[model samples]
Target: MAFFIRWLKAASFLETKTLILDASSYIGGHLFARLGTERAVATYYRNPVGNVVYFDALSMSLSEVVKKTQDITHAVILIGDTKPDSCASDIRKSHALNVESIISIIKFLKERHIKPVFTSTESVFDGIKGSYVETDEVNPILLYGRQKLEIERYLQDYTVDFTILRLSKVYGVSPGDGTIFTSWLEQIQRNETILCSYDQVYSPIYVEDVVDGIIKAIDTGAGGIFHLSGNKPYKRIEMLEMLLSIASEFILQPVNVVRCSINDFGLLEKRPLNVSMVNDKIVKAMGLVPSDARELCSGMIKKFYTNGAMEYR
Candidate 1:
């Protein structure tokens, strides 16, 4: 009995006052539902609020459910469904309305004075120049960017304690399948001509780093807009080459890669050439230096291929 009691104490240390994250709507959608992120986040969530009072922020009302949240000391929202290729109608009919609905949630948190943490993206900028700061001009070039920017603007003068962690290209493996990472691996294995664009340049952060930075923000009570990304910026081709090289080394097979321009792809949305954000603010705030792009990318590759992915044999 004494040994069991001591063991219980050690186990209980990992549990924090319950933290809530809505995902019924956001699940099976974006990077949030991916295996890498879900696995990394499991450590931070002991007795998660979703295990108890379940709520879909987009489908159901956040105001009612947020209040029903028990022992909710802190709430973190990690949901963003829209992207560059999202059609105008999809943005208008769904993504835009989702943002407006989240406002009611913000008000509920304000009533109880619970500081909310929101995830923003680097797409808010036009990417005319790289190494963007928090105060850089936000001329969003895509529908997704417009949606994120709209939310940022709504929170600016609300007299609420909130922290907006604007993220870069977050790379990780999907929980189920068909993530960009998996797709690249599959294409490489099949010896398909991978048309990697040379126009885009951005600092892609690892999912673990982003999750760690978020936990740090929650712990240290950091607020306001902060950029969290890898230490360096890289072109898409450069990054893809690194990924291919790693795969080649692992599977002992050469890859067929094709260098292409962004214009040739005929994409619906105009992608920003340089969406990388300066992580100086987040580094300073957390008093920690972030890993280099190569290191993060390599680690992700290894993890995703550990048990064999959709394509990596």
Candidate 2:
């Protein structure tokens, strides 16, 4: 019995030792930022007991990424979702710049023989319908959605092993600009009125839940497309109201909230009226249960304000 117990302990040790992460993209940057300095460690394969190594893609080349890929038993690619283009020519032109960045990374990882775990957006589905499943056909109207769909096809065609996580709208505070949460936090902090779309519906995943889902997927070796999203669907206006209510409860001043039609925004592409995704596959496969949006938002607000992230906005 003692020998059996020792063997089990050794196996447990080995399991923890084999995982390594190659976080070279923006999503990687944000994920590690949340995981923080304490959990950071060296190569998982070499150390046999370490956590994750945060590799910055900007500083490293494709060769370096390949070297790390060969060294680790498991790796993850964290890329950000593409942003929407506005009707204005200048805005559309500026947003178009991201397409090259997205394509380049995909090409780089492919060349390195590193099968990446791709992160996509629910915007890929035209908001005309809701309750999209894994088998549903994707029809993206927004430029960002189209780009992601293109990449998804590219990866599916070329890569031998890959898992696509089509994420719902994400909410959380980060250090720099970008993210709807950051924008909303800034607007609320300044007591500025924020315009939200009433017609558009989306399910929001808390940043922590996103990270957890990713880790779960990685650990389980589950491949193919999965939707990492919130279980509940809420309209843009409803989300704003919930945010305001949470802020007020936390002693933060309420900001004026305005509802606007999607057409008035002069968006370049049509947005799907519904962007909610079903989470049963991820939940059943990965055993991941996402937190309620309200609770998640409340936690994020507290973390931002108490941790001085609010000051940055």
Candidate 3:
């Protein structure tokens, strides 16, 4: 009995040792600014046994993952996906920096007996579909979605010990700029007209909520697939309206918003109309509740105000 107990303790210790690699750390890059140092440390990662290392996925190859690193219980790969209306250069970056590199990283992690936690996107589905689940069919419309779906398929193979998080449209205050929310804030601050789609709909998960879900998945040792998203879906215009309401409390600016349809854009890729995913599986397993986007965005605005003012990148 004593020997069995000791073995269990050793197993538990091994599980706690993790190497969290934020390949695409921009989503929460400057979260430290808003969350402060100590709180950010506790929120971003908590390891009782092992050390944590943050490196850009593009900077290192799979060979470096094994050669450069020592012991780790698991490795989390949060990389990939190009921005909306990504150009040729952006697509190339997604392939070279994320898609290709992650394949090798997964193989390396598997060989070393380390769990691989990957972040996927809701873009895997064509926007016509809403309330997608883990078992739903994947039909990517954009290049970004297709690449992410390709990774998802690779990880689904029998040999990989992995956790795939299919995330919704992640919305939060980017410490830098260029995010949809930040861009809207920019136009609002300048009192300029903002044009957005009325037909488009998506689950807008706050960046902090995304971080929270990632931690929960790691702690629960979640394998296979899960959806991390907000409690509901909102049209692009609706979200912008909510943001306007929130901004009213902090800023005194009347901004003009012009609502258009998805057809307004004449781009190479046809954007998905509605690709919001349901969070039944993630919520049930992780014991997490879907957050209200409005409340979360309000919190983001408050955080920005507390830090003097929102700075453009």
Count clashes in each candidate, considering only residues at least 3 apart in sequence or on different chains.
1, 2, 0
> 1 or 3, which is superior by TM-score?
3
Q: How does each model score on TM-score?
A: 0.78, 0.73, 0.79
Output candidate 1 Cα RMSD. 7.5
Give the C-alpha lDDT of model 2: 0.64
Q: Report how far off residue 242 is in candidate 2 (Å).
A: 1.6
Order the numbered candidates by lDDT, best leading. 3, 1, 2
List residue ranges in candidate 2 displaced over 4 A: 1-26, 33-61, 68-70, 86-113, 173-182, 249-254, 300-313
**Model 1: residues >4 Å from true position, as ranges?**
1-18, 23-53, 67-69, 87-89, 173-180, 250-253, 299-313
Cα distance off (Å), candidate 1, residue 311:
11
lDDT of 3 by residue, 196-309 (tens): 899988888877777778767766777789998888988889988888888788776567778888778776677888988889898899988767877766776777666655
Candidate 2 lDDT tens digits, 1-313: 3223324534664422211243334445445555443432222212222245444333444454344423223345443334575413344443343344445655665554434567788978987778888888899877677767877887788665667899998776564545676678777766788888898888788777888887776567677899999898888888877777777765546477778976678776656789788989999999998988776667777876777764532
lDDT per residue (tens digit) for residues 93-189 in model 1 = 5564447656766776666555677777898998898889998899988787878887787778784567888888876554444445556876765
lDDT of each: 0.65, 0.64, 0.68
Error at 308, model 3, angstroms: 4.9
